[model samples]
Every structure is written in structure tokens, then in C-alpha cells.
Target: MDCLTSKVQISQFLDNELPQELLQPLFYHLGECEECRNFFVRTKVVHEGAKNVEYAAVPKELDEKFAVLEMGEKNVSLMNRKFTISVPTAIYSIGAVIVMVLFIYVSGTIQEKQIAEQYRQTMNLTMPFSEISYDRN
Candidate 1:
């Protein structure tokens, strides 16, 4: 167990969440590494400090403000309003779609042309008997 691996598992180790297999190796690494040991100590101190600290209560005015904001948001009929796209923007979007379709069509046509060329080459190379004609009575 290196310092990096131990650092990742340190939080879990502090919370007693590591399995028995990992627990021994992690303790061994921490015992050998002084830096990691100090880090673990500082983390423990911070955790203890956080546990002892008191949190402030939420004010009643904040709740009233939030209610007022919520009521104002509800009063606005967003679904009932009509959103209009400008003429130039709508034209540009349609133009983009047209360009995309044309590009796809052109690419498919090019692939078909390439396949046809390959087939023609293969036919020319294999059909040597077609050029020989016989005269029969």
C-alpha cells in the first residue's frame, strides 16, 4: 500500500468502512509513512472540531421570501405564452437541414460510383473469353 492508495482509503478508514483484508495493509503503510501519519492526525482533529461546532438556525424571513418568490413564479403563465422564432433564424435552420441532407446524398452517390468502378475493373480482368469469337458452319 503506497501513500497515494492509502490517501484515497484514509477517509473510509477513519469511518471504519474498510474491509478486514485492506485494513491491515493500510495500517502498516500509515505506520511506516510519517507524512501520511501527520495527515491522518490533522484530519482527525478537523473531524473532531466539526463534531463539536454548533450550526446557526434558519431565519423566518428567509422562508417568507422563498414563499413569495415561489408564488410569483407560479403566477407567471409560462406554458400559455407563445415563443416566436425570428424569420432569419428559421431560414438559417432550414438551410442548414437542407445542406446536411444534400451532403449525405452526395456522399452516398460517391460511394456507389466507387463500388461501380471496382466492379467494372474486376469484370474487365476476369472475362478474357468474351473477346474470342468462333466461326461455325
Candidate 2:
């Protein structure tokens, strides 16, 4: 198997879950390539480290917080209501949209004027050259 394919199967190979056909080729590639060997070593070290590490115990404070929150939830009533847009909020939203549209329009007009100026300058520079070419032809 190629190095790329073998790299993908490395974890599965360590766990003895890789297919039999790929096993020998992967081992051969790992032995021949120094980079792959180093990668394999790092992966193996990480795997072993993870396996030997102990999980921490949960804090007692978390249980107390949950108990207080459950008590609060029991005293609260769940409310279901339809959403409505207030007139002031709707007016502010419309004003924001209009400001954005005006900004875009002004910016676009400025860009268009700049592009036109550039085109005129290019034409002015090439006018003499065009006359010379026309005379030669």
C-alpha cells in the first residue's frame, strides 16, 4: 500500500482492525520510510498516553448548582407566545436598510466615475499610436 493509504490505516493497524491484505505492505512502508516511522512513533506514544491517563472526578459544586437550578425550574411556568414586531423597531430596521442602500449606491457611483477616468486616460495615451499605425497600414 502507498504511504498515504498506510498512514490512514496506521491507527487501525495498531488496533489490529486493518484488513489482512494491507497489513504486510503497511508494515514494509513504515519500516522503509523514516518520516513514517517517526509519525508512527508519535501516534503510538499518544495512544499509549491516552490509554494510561486517569479521568478526573466530577466536582461536588456541580451537583449543588443542578439541585438549585431544578428547584427554580419547578417554580417557573413555561410560556408560549407569538412573536410581534414593534413599530419603533420596524422603523429603525427600515432606516438601517435605507442607509445601507444609499451607501452602496454612492460607492458604486464613485467607482464608476474612477473607471471612466481611467478609460479616458488610456484612450488619450493610445490616440497618437493609433494614428501612426493607421498611416503605416
Model 1 lDDT tens row, 12-128: 877878777898788898999998898889998987888999988789999987897778776775756678999999999999999999999999999987887687687785544
C-alpha-based local distance difference test score of model 1? 0.84
Candidate 2 residues 32-122, lDDT tens each? 9887888899999998898989989879998887898877766663444447899999999999999999999999999987887687687
Say what the RMSD of model 1 is: 24.6
Against the true structure, candidate 2 has what lDDT? 0.82
- Return the TM-score for candidate 1, rounded to 2 decimals: 0.42
Error of 2 at 91 (Å): 91
Best-performing candidate as measured by lDDT: 1
